[model samples]
Target: MTAAVDVRARLVDRLEASGVLTPGWRQAFLDVGRHEFLPDVFWASTGDGYERCDRARSPERWLELAYSDVAIVTQWDDGTSSGQQREPTSSVSMPTMVASMLRDLDVHEGHKVWEGGTGPGWNAGLLARRQGAHNVVTVELDAVVAAQAAANFRALDIAPTAVVGDAAHGYLPGAPYDRGILTCSVRHVPPALIGQIRRHGVLVLPFAPLFGGGAVARLTVTGTTVTGTTATGPFTGSSAFMRMRQQRYQAPPVDDYLPGDWPGDAVREYTTLNPLNVVDDWLASFVVGLAVPDLYYRRSNNGGSGMTTLWLFDTGVTSWATVDFVDGASRFEVRQSGSRRMWSEVEDTVRWWTAAGRPGFERFGLTLEGGEHRAWLHQPANPLPSPRGQD
Candidate 1:
């Protein structure tokens, strides 16, 4: 326990240095024990995949991880397979990210907070500890995970109203919250959630596009259902959070797009722009995703050849493209089929972004209104170019 405390002190110091852990959140972070909410076993990232860590077998390591900045996956396959499959359905988020989102939240004293993803209830515990447990309400989709988190809250001597249900719908019983935050990432900000936050109320969440990449969004509820609820805000920084359970992407298999041999109906071509540069960078993915919301991608590597293939597809199932990337090649072979030319669209979007000056995530913002989302640069009026327009 002493070692855990010491470890937490270092983490708090690190976060404070990072400027995300402000004075308002420092005490709650210090008081609320993060490890108390964690399960006996959790999965830690190993770059390639996840490595299981069990407290019973390695008590010291588990304790270190609990206080570390890294996220710990607590459930896999929604706990059906007990993490044997490594699907990462739920987790206690990284300390840095938790603090960053809380910073983005900018909560005030006596403010009623509604949290969408309870996970292990650590974030809610911090909020409860700061604002008083009665003022914080957290909802979780997985009943088993919620049950465990409730137990952990009691164990920590902190109790925030924990509801077991889909967070996307939000818990309306505690409506008109002063501030709201969602632990999970969403391609679309739920209208139901927007309705829960009072007008001018701040809602911090992760706004991810279907293409790839995501960032933390700090939105202020601007309008409500009388006209249509709208939450407009800028992304705070880069983030890689697990998708909201109901919002996870169920991508169609490659076979569904190509029923026969390689490039069966795809028109073969070549281009100088190597997608290697685009996919390797997060900001690139975010920009391209904003331009092409329905797009998604996959990568296949050639064994020992230092060569790769980047596959692009649209959610509408109308198009597919692949760029064969070879080292030191002046131009790469490209193939496309169907109504839309995805590779060409990517090439044009990349060029446009370059022409306009490469803007990072901070320059981008999102507006969710009338059951639709429009990502823009700098402000709401200047929306990202349409993928079709890029053609």
Candidate 2:
């Protein structure tokens, strides 16, 4: 056997041992190799930026990258650049994540499946394997990426219908799907998805709020409403993903937050809670973001100083908060301006979270009804408090 095939086998063995690939998905996992759908050139994230990997220049390295458990960027800036740029618009996610999602999907034979964000067709191929090829429909908003995915499907002899359009507007022709899965993240569950799914159908999508953190949600559609809990257990780390094209974040300029005579009317105070202890934890941040809607933050460290400043802002640009953290200090200084008192809201959330025993993301659930979404902790009957000061 070739080296590439050997690497692929090793990966399958690893996944199988980890219990990520159950018996139901083992055949599909072994049959569909991720390397087949990948292009000659792709980008790998290096934390700070992405590095390009070319097949021709280094076939061995390429195979190592393709077989390894890492997300590869297939397109940059929506296919405008030639994979040289660090900004990735579309990617083939790591095998571990894909496997976990498929296991959670729990699709049955002959079930019609709908997939959003068909980057390179690897995921589509896997779905087609589980559910017949004719029953799987995948959508991509980027025309170029959609075409490429279609071509990849064809090359692999798979016949899943690929659509080029906004994923938010799902494929209407293939409505009433038994299952709906999104490869990318969304600020909220799309209303169209709920309308398209049949009653009792399951929809899994990455729920990312406007703030910082996110989690994978599995909700069951019931007529026009949908409800489910987060599947983010301790084993799974934060599933932060690239936002869907339409749901990408757009933040106001820093100058807008700090205008002439900044802090002119800002109120100053001190808090015992440390910003690092709150915002740094992924679970805490996700809960805080859910409780505080339209809230976003940024952090900066002073050069050569043992201090960091966390700045919070709202979507309206009306309310703002700043917390300065001093190294080895028991307390931090906080300043707030405008009507919202963003700092107070975040502090209250942190306190409530601690009082509640610091629930994990899995403890949170979401409900969508009549075009509105409600986040709840533990159960749907008890809704999470809204930052708008509503119960």
Candidate 3:
């Protein structure tokens, strides 16, 4: 047996033991060769930034990463450049995320499946194995990536109909699907996606808020185009997937907010809550984002001062707040300005989350109705409170 096969078996063994790989899906997991879909070069996150890995230069490490539980960056800047000059646009998603999403899909034999963002086509390949190849339709917005995925599928002799278009709209030619899964994340569930699914059909995707954190949403479609379609489901687990290309955020430049000197007309205040805790914890970020909408942040380091500043801003480009932190310091300095108090909103949201015993991602559920997404704690009836001020 080859080393790749040995590592793939071990990876499956670990996932099965973790309970993400179920009994029915074991054969599909064992059969799909993930490495077959990889490109010559990929990037892996090292916390600070992404590190480039090339198959030709380091074959052993590259093969190990192919099966290991990590997202490998496949395309950069939407296929515009091969050099690592900007953020990653496409990737083979993390293995655990892949397994968990498949579990959430709850697919059955003969069920027609629609997949969005067929990065390297591994997920599509796996779906075709369980459901027949004819019943699966995978869509990709990038034509180049789509062609590569098609070639990979052909090499494996597994032919799932591949469509080159925006996944947000889905493939109408194969509509009324039993299941729809998105490999990328979206700020909110699209109305178009809901209209394409049959009533009571499941659609699983990573739902992220503008603030920061995100989770896997497993929703069941209801109603119709004429009847006001909606989807409701609980967050299955925490996830960090690239946002859909069409739904990407466009924040205003820092100069637009601060035209002159720092804290030109800003208010100043201090709080004991460490920005470190809020910035580091994924669950905390999720809570803050769910509670407060239209809010986001950026971090910076003071020049050799051992001080870090966490800056918060709204999508409106009117309000800005900065909280300065130093290692081992009990009190941190803060400054705020504009009509809406962005820092106050974040601090209030974080405190509320802490007071409520800090629920995990599974405790939260989402409901998309009337063209708006509402997040709730435990059940859909009780919606999370939206921050007072907005753009």
Worst 10 contiguous positions by lDDT, candidate 2: 228-237
What TM-score, to 2 decimals, does candidate 3 have?
0.94
Q: Give the worst 10-residue stretch by lDDT in candidate 1.
A: 78-87
Runs of candidate 2 exceeding 4 Å displacement: 46-51, 81-86, 225-237, 254-259, 303-306, 387-391
Model 1 scores a C-alpha lDDT of: 0.88
Q: Candidate 1, after superposition: displacement of residue 105 in Å? A: 0.4
lDDT values, one for every candidate: 0.88, 0.81, 0.88
Clashing pairs in 3: none
Q: Candidate order by TM-score, highest to lowest?
A: 1, 3, 2
Using lDDT as the yardstick, the better of models 2 and 3 is: 3
Query: lDDT by residue for model 1 over 255-333, one digit each (tens)?
Result: 8888988879899999999888989888898888888988889999989898899999988787899999999999999
lDDT of 3 by residue, 94-158 (tens): 78889989999999888999999998899999999999899999999999999999999999999
User: How many residue pairs collide in each prediction?
Assistant: 0, 0, 0
Better of 1 and 2 by lDDT: 1
